[model samples]
Target: MPQHTPDHPTRQILTLDTGVDAVEPGPDQRWSTWPSIAKGQRGPHPHPDWVVTAAAALDTELGVLKTGKEADVFLVERAVPDDPDRAVLLAAKRYRDTDHRQFHRAGTYTEGRRERRSRDQRATQDRHSAWGRSVRATQWADAEFATLCALWEAGAPVPYPVQIDGTELLLEFVGHVDDAGAAVAAPRLAQTRPDTDLLADWFEQVRSAMGVLARLGWAHGDLSPYNVLADGERLVVIDLPQVVDLVANPFGAELLHRDCRNMGAWFAARGLEVDVDALFAEVFAQAW
Candidate 1:
């Protein structure tokens, strides 16, 4: 193990030591918007703390790349900058305690049933005792880190996970952190303003991604227009917390089939004659 001292160059990565001051068992209603998002939603948002922590840990002051409903991504620095591509970007998933009494998120998002179950379990656990908050916090930390590592090892185009501590996740940042000139906005295949050549390129990229999926024994459980990012000539996939390991799950084959089908459907929607069945067959057949 590397002995990372306080002043060690690698010590730029920070820690999620945000103070948990709420001793009493209660929920914050202001940010509670999900049906079960905040069931165990406790304390204030630790993202800011996590952000600062990740930056210090990675040894770079990460500029904000983008902000979504659940997380914020930042382009942090690499511990050693000798190599130009040696730096790492941090995607600090700010834990959202958006669970409230008004909305039913459980009914809305049908993507990752397992993740949903974990959320519900945490929420249930959160309501009963203060320890539920601890459990929920640790679970989210584990899920994101585990998936990020899996994809990286599987040759998937994703931010590589460095280390996951507390509510913070340190990993390789994607793109130039989304700037005007260096930004690669996630191109919804449905809305991409590409020519025929670009369309073919996209088809090949999605197909290659499917290959990566099949080779890795996993599949993007909810691949669609939103998850694909157009990084210049290459189309990179993101938001894969629901990626399932096919070799581990019996229903994984169906998930992988649906993944290719989903991508094929996107092409078909654009008037391309995509044979979803053949594509599914090719992806599932383990010739490798």
Candidate 2:
């Protein structure tokens, strides 16, 4: 029998008389998934220069950034070995399987949405069926990826959607490296305590983003301080899987109003006089 010494806790090696023939990836590192997925599954054309698309690239999972009812977000670094310049950090949001997901409000948000395939439509409606559960699991991921791409192109303050592979959506990480040279996710707006001027600026950013969504006849159906990330002076909206079609969804206006009130209340508590009704009226006016 040959003796082998493990290089890393997550690595495994098999040695033969000839030499080491096979090795398994470490727990955190895996081959780039980009090459296996279809081109159509990739992000929009003219992908950002930072996006790592090389076939030789490897993805190393840093850690989990967030965990929610529908999905969990992980920090992933994609890079080619020995190529430091070709590296980038991405937020990989992986949706839960139907068995684990708790999409309590999915019906309400998906009211105006429909599956293109009749089979999928029928399957999604049959919640108890395995096929239906699988379809439902992927639907939210697909929806969010498409929404991010459209919003990014329309100039909304959204994270760049790098690509979506099944239920895992890879997005541009929206934060700076910390003093320790580690990636730190930006604080949620709810966690920030800003001065009056900065608060006002943040409000303007939120308002501008909402206006863009309104003009597109859509609404961030679940907007709240918790879903907005404050990276320095910049505000980036996240978790838009439930974006509503203001014209087509019956509850669109109601959801839009809630979005305004949610953020307005936050600003109001911080000494910013936010007129929720006025904000709602202004945003709704742009839907036409």
Candidate lDDT scores, in order, read 0.52, 0.84
Candidate 2: TM-score? 0.90
Global local distance difference test of model 1 = 0.52
- Residue-wise lDDT of candidate 2 within 122-177, one digit each (tens)? 99989799899889989999999988887877778888888889899999887767
Q: What C-alpha root-mean-square deviation, in Å, does candidate 2 show against the real structure?
A: 10.8
Candidate 1 lDDT at 184 equals: 35
Could you tell me the lDDT of residue 23 within candidate 2?
42
RMSD of each: 11.2, 10.8
TM-scores of all predicted structures: 0.58, 0.90
